[model samples]
Target: MPFFVYGTLRPGEHNHDRFVRGRDVRAQPAFLHGGALYDGPGHPFATDGDGTVRGALLTAAPAEYPGLLVALDRLETYLGPGDPRNLYERVVRPVEVPGSGTVRAWVYLAAPAVTRTLRANGPRIPGGDWLSHRPPRTDRLLPPPGPRTP
Candidate 1:
């Protein structure tokens, strides 16, 4: 099964390699329609809205899916279906895969109350792309563009 991840769970983000790498058989850039993304405490959360969420559709081996889902559920702080303490709810949603068209994939979404609170004050990630909204790393060693003219 494929899971759509839009936040830190996406590649190169904080939790990707730790949680998703190796577990996933393949990953393709994809988009979730009708959603808005918000910057949470240390990650991002998505809610149903009138926008598109940029993400990746990751295919996990059938045998790995169950365990992966369990680990992800724990990582996302989801106690279980309808648990009040749940920060996210796993649901099946349609993701638009570039070359493969639409596919149903599991996605984690913030609870409605959580979504409301986050949206009321938290910064909305422009274009629903977490990777795009992140600030550039100050620790990277890339040289400054062109030599200084001074």
Candidate 2:
């Protein structure tokens, strides 16, 4: 199955060049329904919800599929099904590809523990589009403009 990438794994993101570049047969815009995106430490996490998450469906080259699967599992910290240490759980979900119909693809979603935490405190990414989502600023606030120095 193709992988549905919704966060850093999407094209032009930091992880894309390192993990997905040259390994995919095609990467196209896709959407996953009944899901929501939440801001993670540096990336974004998808969880089961009522909203739609925007991402890409990446069909890996036949020769690269096996390795790509292993790599993605490791990157997402998915040790196995129901593993306590897993941050994300890999599951097959239906993704809608533009021009094409819906296809079942591998999707990484926040694990139960992570989802609980996210529900309690994590900020949801508006519009569920990680590529266009900008995290809120964390920089210290500055005082109102004082008299300009010469």
Candidate 3:
């Protein structure tokens, strides 16, 4: 099975080694349209139509598909289809792989309600690329108040 992975699941990201490294037979750059990506805490969440998301198309051996799916589900905190607690839903969508044309692949996306909330509150990742994003500066305005006086 082929899975479309963005955010931490991309090669070199934190979760890639643990969840996809050796388990997958192949991975290549791919693009999916009709959705938007957002900054959600340590990772990114995908929302419905009208934008593009750049990611990798990871393909696993048929024999490894089941196990890989289970592992990914655990990492994503996905319960079953329509489960209220699911952090991301694994859905099949068309992804355009360079040189390979369009292929159907499994992708994780947020629920409709959650997508709305994220849009309202989260930072949208421009260009749909996560690796290029830099976190906002966090420097303090002044020194630490020089320890408290007695």
- RMSD for each model, in Å, please? 5.3, 7.0, 7.1
Evaluate residue 78 in candidate 1 and report its C-alpha lDDT on the 0 to 100 scale.
Answer: 84
lDDT of 1 by residue, 10-88 (tens): 8777688788877745788999999999888768899988899999988888888888888999998888787889889
Name the best candidate (by lDDT): 2
Candidate 3 off by > 4 Å = 134-150
**Alpha-carbon shift of residue 133 in model 2 (angstroms):** 0.9
Task: Looking at model 2, report the run of 10 residues with the lowest lDDT sum.
Answer: 134-143
List, residue by residue over 1-150, the lDDT tens digit for candidate 2: 999999888887768878988775589999999999999999999999999999999998889999999999999999999899999999999999989999999999999999999989999998999878855434325666679979
**What are the per-residue Cα lDDT tens digits for candidate 3 across 31-126?**
999989898887889877689999999899998899989999889888888888888888999999999999999999986667778978988999
Question: Which rank order by TM-score, best down to worst?
Answer: 2, 1, 3
Which residue pairs overlap in candidate 3's backbone?
34-49
List lDDT for all candidates, in order.
0.86, 0.91, 0.84
Model 3 per-residue lDDT at 110: 89
What is the clash count for each candidate, in the order shown? Answer: 0, 0, 1
**Which regions of candidate 1 fall more than 4 Å away from where they truly are?**
137-150
Tell me each candidate's TM-score: 0.87, 0.88, 0.85
> lDDT-based ranking, best first?
2, 1, 3
